[model samples]
Target: MRVNADFTKRVAVHFDRNDWIASPAAGVERKMLDRIGEEVARATTIVRFAPGSAFAAHTHDGGEEYLVLDGVFQDETGDFPAGSYVRNPPTSSHTPSAKEGATILVKLHQFDPEDRTEIRRSITGDSNLQLFKDSREDVRVLNLSPGEKLDLDAVDGLELFVIAGSVQESDEEFSVWDWLRLPPGARSTALAGAEGARIWIKSGHLSQMI
Candidate 1:
């Protein structure tokens, strides 16, 4: 059950919201971008929880990072609305539900054991690009305007998810919910299109996975 499991190659791909398929969970679905192993796997996915749907409690042996795209997502911690970014470190457990529905971009089992910091952020903050991991600036979010470009210099690996607006790089035009991953030495300069773009970037972790 592997999808785009190669960690050594550079990949530049895009998927629309409608490209998703149903998940095993009733009232839920997924658009899987990358995966390794089975149910409990190293994966990156866009999960949509139907109204009044919930998932059973589960433990994150590796870690989990997620961003709410729309609607409200709830857990034991709190209710997270759109524009919320959250990270749950290794060994974290929770039961997730969305009373009104929600679409979220989530990454599972993708954190280093040493990276045990838990963070939650809302879009209301003035810090457009806030670093979740201290010192190295590995994981963060960015708010961009039309015609703006983010240069990637000496990045060993990179992952970008367009949360809003249209984003472009070379010939790839990405609207909301599009994700792109690049391996070591790959060029991934993101340029915003007409409506501008807000993106989540995970840099320097792919090539150095722990």
Candidate 2:
């Protein structure tokens, strides 16, 4: 059940080109990127929900994080449209579905026990973003133009997943569904494509490994 389970090595994979494997839920399919357990394992995957599809209520003992890639995702809280980022803390439960269908980049069972913050962000709203700079870190979640590079300080690491367009690191290229994880103290630059790019990035989290 281990796919790209090695933490020390750099891993990059294109999800759009991968096969869509059916999940246990009816009308739900997933493109597994990395997995390490059985049905309720620590895993990262790209999931798609067919129209009128829904999943049974379930609890995430280890937590869940997801970004809506296309269409809308629904739960008891509300509906999350494309470009939304959500995190459900440990021991949280929900029954998720989509009437018009949806696609999401989902990460499960990968959270620090002490990090108990729940977040839901809608990129469409202007108040959801802020620009700040400091001596140790520079953080922002907005538009990134082509050839623009972000330098994460040595104390932290960089993790980015492309929401749209394309991203290139070293010789590896990632499209919409691709993901990149740089190790601690690792230096990497991203170049967006002609269509520009939108990305979700998290820094200062390399030490917290699952």
Candidate 3:
């Protein structure tokens, strides 16, 4: 199964709650944005857990990354509220659930084979611009007020995902969980909507494996 599988081309979409389809798990559902392979695959999705829902303990042979969008996500490690970002490197294992329910944006099997660092960050503070740096890439979250514009430099494989409100790229507008990916050497700027915008930006990734 594949959705937006072309790595050389740009793919974009707005996440719709109605598009969520229940997974094999009783109360867990997902809105798949891109995927390749069967049950165990390279994929990106927005997942939701109904109250009391839980997933069995499992190992990620490739890797896993996620950002909590709403409610709380819990595991043996601790409880993570909305605006939390977590990265479980290749071969990591965990049992994840939501007691109060939750919605999250997640990526599976997308890490470089040698990149095994574990990361967890809180994004619940006041809205602002922040960066997450790594030898392989730089990730940034921009919280922009109405009519605000943020300049983005050209880089190799730029990826943008609008988490909330609205953002404009060039003259194009995106809203509510829209996604976009650009190739190396691409340049651009983003502008916020009247209500403000919160966006996640990351770059310096191998496009072929995406």
TM-score, structure 3 vs. true: 0.89
* Model 3 residue 16 lDDT score: 51
Kindly list the per-residue Cα lDDT of model 2 for residues 62-94, writing each as its tens digit. 889888989999999999999787888888899
C-alpha lDDT (0 to 100) for residue 183 of candidate 3: 65
Residue 68 shift from truth in candidate 2, angstroms? 1.0
**Model 2 vs. true fold: TM:** 0.85
The best candidate in terms of TM-score: 1
Error (Å) of candidate 3 at residue 201 is 1.0
lDDT of 1 at 25: 75
Residue 131 lDDT, candidate 1, scale 0-100 = 53
Clashes of each: 0, 0, 0
Look at candidate 1 and tell me the lDDT of residue 118: 92
Task: List clashing residue pairs in candidate 3.
Answer: none
Please give the CA lDDT of all the candidate structures.
0.81, 0.75, 0.82
Show the lowest summed lDDT stretch of 10 residues, model 3: 124-133
What tens digits encode model 1's per-residue C-alpha lDDT throughout 1-210? 988888777555566544677876789888888888788999998899999998889999999989999899999999999988899999999999999999898999978777778988886443577657654447777888899988865266788887778888866888877878877777657789988887888877776642
Q: Write the per-residue lDDT of candidate 3 for residues 61-116, one digit (tens) a residue.
A: 88988899999998888898998999888999999999999999888998777777
